[model samples]
Target: VSLQELMEPEAGTNRTAVAEFTLLGLVETEEMQSVVFVLFLFAYLVTVGGNLSILAAILVEPKLHTPMCFFLGNVSVLDVGCITVTVPAMLSHLLSHRPTISYGACLTQLFFFHLLAGMDCFLLTAMAYDRFLAICRPLTYSIHMSQTVQRMLVAVSWTCAFTNALTHTIALTTLNFCGPKEVNHFYQLSCSSTQLNELLLFALGFLMVGAPVVLIIASYIHVAAAVLQIRSAEGRKKAFSTCGSHLTVVFLFCGTGIFNYMRLGSEEASEKDKGVGVFNTVINPMLNPLIYSLRNTDVQGALWRILVGRWSLT
Candidate 1:
């Protein structure tokens, strides 16, 4: 059925209160769908397992009980949540004859997706702030970023993110999706239906999205200044090394996200935007644990010890 047909249900009947929405799936062809199904499933599992491993290592090992590791554990948990919200649903719909999601479930998905993704942004910013303290203000870092303070910051970020998600959800629900129930992309939203919301989301999203990037940049600028003042070249290298992983993550997470949303504003990027969406939602989550694990000596040592510990036990 053409999109026009879905938009105009028999003129006599009312379709304002849509019961459900049909997704267009990832690719056009059935064969492509099967391939995407395997790919997405593999990505989801790796994302979950890798993040869980990060969490497990932190939990069993006492050395990882510091403020940095604690916040990282929170990021791992959010990464798991971030992927779970979309990938499982996308996977279920990938090969189904009727790729549909009910109204409430769809809205619920939108809510949690934003909630967790927003938390990811804030948490990264918080991590940058933690680094700022640990590096720039080393002596006062312990006093300023105590366990209680760290926990409180994390709790506040969650609360704020939850509230931000709720606001976006409310704005979305304000629009009545009475038109075509078929969502052209993998997710469920008729393009024509969301034009208004898309524009609004971008405008509002500047604060949600732009604020974090700005904050991260500002934090790093201060960090650079602090590093430059270090008398020894080795000292500066060590400081930058501690921050390298986080900066890489921030770029990967925000760079793809910005591209995806920027594409939302144009019709030409319809298909390409889907690819960007997949990158941010699926690929980014999977990469986060890998980035931290590979970049940090602490995570590497912990994982090594963990493997040997289990190996000896068995």
Candidate 2:
């Protein structure tokens, strides 16, 4: 049978299987295209430069050789991977008049995009817990969270993220995208589907993403409570300062994430909604390292020391 016949076997039907999709670039105006291209290009370059500098600073500064910097390094790696997954494709589409993505390519992009995003989520939570232990239980922190334990935590975070992405991607792969292959967003992997895939995706979102967020919140709450119990003003200030940057990142990351996913079920989602989703995914990954490094004096000093030839990798 022909492709159309296989898609709609009944006579006089008006459907054919959609084998590919056209991603509606962010906007329709040619002027807007150039503007967005330049803007995002600058952003992408800055993100890459900032994260690479942070990674280099961490590696060169022996003072940064700790579990915290190790975790930060992983976050930087995830940021680069996450931004790379979407920015290149997005930039290409924005610059070109006609933009298209193959079905397989869309799925591949979706897989890595979600993979890095999931890793960021879990890693942020791990970072929070790490800070909590460091601040709230300084004496036993090393004993409880040794180097081996920290490595295990990081490994588990990446493994869980990959598994979550794989589950969503596999579930989406089983979906049949037979028509209307035009995605009305810049960088999403949405597909035509029956109800089963939607339900599975929802379940996976809750289990993999939602559960970790809850745990993260609980951890920070305890951290905050511990900080409050500090009798000395200097101790309270120091503890709060240590966690402030992390808290800012956590809120920005999780707040945008929850907002985006909550709207997935809404039938009335607007183009702006998709725009915000793309903005969060493409922009926030790069911002995480900058926010942390800029806000934390220790990280700033480490970078300075590395730059001034005062630090060595050995």
Candidate 3:
């Protein structure tokens, strides 16, 4: 049956509340669905395994017990959460004939997705701050980034993320969803005017998204100035190397995120934009652990030692 037929009210019934939403899976063709499902399933496994490996390394490797690694571990957890919220459901829906999600479940998914994603943005900013202290203010780094201070930063990031997610969820619930239970793109289903939602999005885009990018940029500015003042070429390279992985991650995550969120005011996202969404949600999570492990000798050495130790034992 067509989506319109599914949405139409039964005879003698008036417009009713939306109890569930139909999902337009990534592809319509069965053959394409199978291929896409395999690809995404592989990507999901890699993302989970790679992040778990990073977390495991952080736990077993004493060298990774620093403030930076602590933040990285939290980020790994968030990355896993970020992908798990949507991907698994999407995978299941890909195979089902009538793929649908209940109204409550849909909102719950929305809430957690935003929460984890917002936490990622804040955590990256915190990481940039940590790098700033370590590189620009070396002597005071230990004092400023104490274990207690590190915990506080994490707490603040999560609290801010929770608040933002809650606000968005509440605002969405206030909207009246009268018909058309199909969710094709972003959460743009509302019978009422979305002016309030748009305003909140624009305002919080600055607070939650734009603000972090600004802070990250400012932190790197100081870091760049400090690294330039280094006398030896090796010293400068080392400084840049420490941040290179993080910079790459930040660009990959935030760049696509900004592109997606900034264009929400438009009537609908283009297919190209949806492709960017796939890259952001699926491809980016899988890349983070690889980027860090490949770039950082500490992570590589730790992973290598763990592997060799297990090998010798076996």
Best by lDDT: 3
Candidate 3 to truth, TM: 0.94
Pairs with backbone N, CA or C atoms under 3 Å apart (clashes), candidate 1: none
| Candidate 1 structure lDDT | 0.79
- On residues 7-92, what C-alpha lDDT tens digit does candidate 3 reach at each position? 44535766656667777666778899889889989999999999998999999999999998999999999989989988898888
lDDT of 2 by residue, 224-277 (tens): 898898899999898887788777878887778777777764546476786677
* Predicted candidate 1 versus true structure: per-residue lDDT over 238-273, tens digit per residue: 899888989998998889888866755343436666
Superior by lDDT: candidate 2 or candidate 3: 3
Residue pairs clashing in model 3 are: none
Report per-prediction Cα RMSD to one decimal.
3.2, 4.9, 2.5
> Distance (Å) between predicted and true CA of 7, model 2?
11
lDDT of each: 0.79, 0.74, 0.86
Against the true structure, candidate 1 reaches a TM-score of 0.89
Off by over 4 Å in 1: 1-15, 180-183, 186-200
